[model samples]
Target: MSTTTTAPGTVPAAGTTPGAAQGPPKSRRSRRPGLIPTVVLLAGAGYCLLPVAWVLIASTKSSRELFSTFTFLPGTGFTRNVADLSAYRDGVYWQWMLNSLFYAGVGALLSTAVSALSGYALAKYRFRGRESIFNILLTGVLMPPVILAIPQYLLMAKAGLADSYTSVLLPSILSPYGIYLARIYAAAAVPDDVVEAARMDGAREWGIFTRIALPMMLPGLVTVFLFQFVAVWNNFLLPYIMLGDDEKFPVTLGLYTLLQQGASAPALYTLVITGALLAIVPLIALFLVIQRFWSLDLLSGAVKS
Candidate 1:
């Protein structure tokens, strides 16, 4: 082969010279951070977090100090608030917390499993009415829980499920959004070749799904679990409509009751604020524990299947 020589001090085209500049360098505008986006994000974070900060501070205040002192001022009632909340209704606040944990934990687990299996089948299998089924599921996401709650309650009442744990739970187990996420994740994270190979090895379909596909799809499943967990934990409307007993109440419902009581007795204002502050501790702890399972790569389809 003949060697190609380029003009002196000039960048050569590909194959003309080795290690030559290909094009002009990217501009400073392209490399530097976008100022507007950064400011907007900071503003959004502050807006969301400001109320939480207020709750933390306000929980520390006694009912008298709540209005008397500055908004951000710390009072000496932090421990006292905990004691009062603990003593209220024979520590029913803890019962509500336990109920919420049970509901969210069981609901998230069941939701994640169903979503994973449904998503995998939808993604991997070729069946009739598959798209229609998925579309119907997605339609549920459009219907807000507020609009659906009354109807759900009526149905539960007809089925003798009203005022029962099943009424609150069964409705929450099927998450349209979680199914959507799982489908996307399964499609992205599971390889067709791997699935085919498993089939050729005399492995059953369920075995392939449980052993081979599930491992690859774990990150996405974790994300679904997290979403459903938060949704069930923060849920108010379904429980409000379904359950009549205070013993079965979740933290959200319990707080609403306290607020109603606080309207009559201003002393309960401190209890309400303190309960609200304590309410978020579990979620914070959960985030710290499961933060690693949340990956942009899995969500954005950046990881190889």
Candidate 2:
């Protein structure tokens, strides 16, 4: 009487056939997704994208096609739409674009710098009133922009600086949320021993920060910069109230005025939509460009460099 061993994953010598000998029947759990979550997620994505999708499609249509045709289909008027936008008011749209760049670029750079310094200080140092200072800045985060904008406008007026570029750019530079993010980043990225090593080499505190901590904190700072950039770029009320001149308007306020006019003209509706589409183009482009450089882990301060 000879016995043989079966190969792995094969049926054993039970008193049954190959398919049935190895094990009991496997359970047939359903692999399909439940209806509710799938529907909810798809609905959310559609809700978020419907406006954006509409803008992209609408920006391609002429004023006539915009009203006459179905909403979702692309049109042949993209070139003409861009040309008309380019030709509008001696190309004031370009000026608004430039103004938005100036406000967001300058404001975000300054805000990131201040947030870095303040955050580094709070994270590393143990000076008197440190907690108090952080708490005060946190309070600024809770304060509504509506509340601050009025007082800021009043103060700028007293200083004879209302209706100017400075009035728009200056107030936005001190961002409490940016500081908060910076603090979290600094605490995580920066190490005590590195600062101690720098100090041992006779490096000043500012030198250590500029040379050592900043390089380590760069990834997180990009997030602050990007956040503040979008915030300033999209800001309408501050620039609207502070700057009366259309030439000084950022794209948001500028497009808003165009929309107001469109209420009567109706033709300007296409231009307004076109301008909005153009305004968002750079943001999408910037995200794609910086996405490679951004270390998302730095947002959580998980990186140890």
Candidate 3:
């Protein structure tokens, strides 16, 4: 047997043809983000965070120093702002906060439940006009909530629910987007064979869903809950139109009123800023608390085909 003598480094390996051209060195290829993308991301971050920074800084400032000084400078009035906000109209700010929590909390829970049921049915059950129904929901997802506000208001007025918490809570409970998300998530996360196995074990539909499908779909439902909660928490238009009672107003609407009043008084601007800053705390805390649920691996021990 003749052996092929190979020169060090320059020789081809066993399979490669001799004198084959080599590609460029790996070190020459750049893996870092391009300058333009980096710039764009930085710009986007600044655009988003600048307002938050301003809110934080402004919230710490008193009304006198709000505009009189530099924009980003921190002031010494944070405690005073809190005190004034607490003292404003017998602590009505807290009432708005409580109202927001109610709307967002109750609305998110109900919406998530409806979405879970509707999505699971649409994804798993084959029925007549299922696609049509899903398509209609997609259309609803496309339709802006702003456009529906007037009709919702009209319906609520007709039902004598206008200016009540029920109007806001009821409208928030049926989220088309949440349903859409749930359906997609169910189709992806909940396996068909697992469902069939549950059926073969004589598990009722409701029991299978509650026991098996629900655990698998928990992350998606959490996402839907977060979305709906944030939407209702930050909602301004629907509540603005549906409610005339300032006492029932959510934090968003309450802040808007303070903003409008600030136009004349200018002192209320500090209160508005302080209120806006505080309004975001619950959402942040909620995200931090609920994020752990998303990390659960519920499908690890799922039945394998």
On TM-score, the leading prediction is: 3
Best by lDDT: 3
Clash numbers, per candidate: 0, 0, 0
lDDT of 3 by residue, 1-305 (tens): 75655587775667776655677566633755476689999999999999899999999998788879776879999999999999999999999999999999999999999999999999999999999999999999999988899999999999999999999999999999999999999999899999999999999999999999998898899999999999999999999999999999999999999999988888898999999999999999999878755543344434342
How many backbone clashes are present in model 1?
0
- The better candidate by lDDT, 2 or 3, is 3
C-alpha-based local distance difference test score of model 2: 0.91
Q: Which pairs clash (backbone N, Cα, C closer than 3 Å) in model 1? A: none
Query: Every model's Cα RMSD, please?
Result: 5.9, 4.5, 4.3
Backbone collision tally, model 2: 0
Choose 2 or 3, whichever is better by TM-score.
3
Q: Mind giving the per-residue lDDT tens digits that candidate 1 earns over 45-105?
A: 9999999999999999887889786768788989999999999999999999999999999
Name the lDDT of candidate 3: 0.93
Candidate 2 C-alpha lDDT tens digits along 1-305: 75556578865565765444455665544434466679999999999999999999999988889989676989888888788888999999999999999999999999999999999999999999999999998998898888888999999999999999999999989999999999999999899999999999999999999999998899889999999999999998899889999999999999999999998999888889889999998899878767967646445455554
TM-score ranking from best candidate downward: 3, 2, 1
Q: lDDT rank, highest first?
A: 3, 2, 1
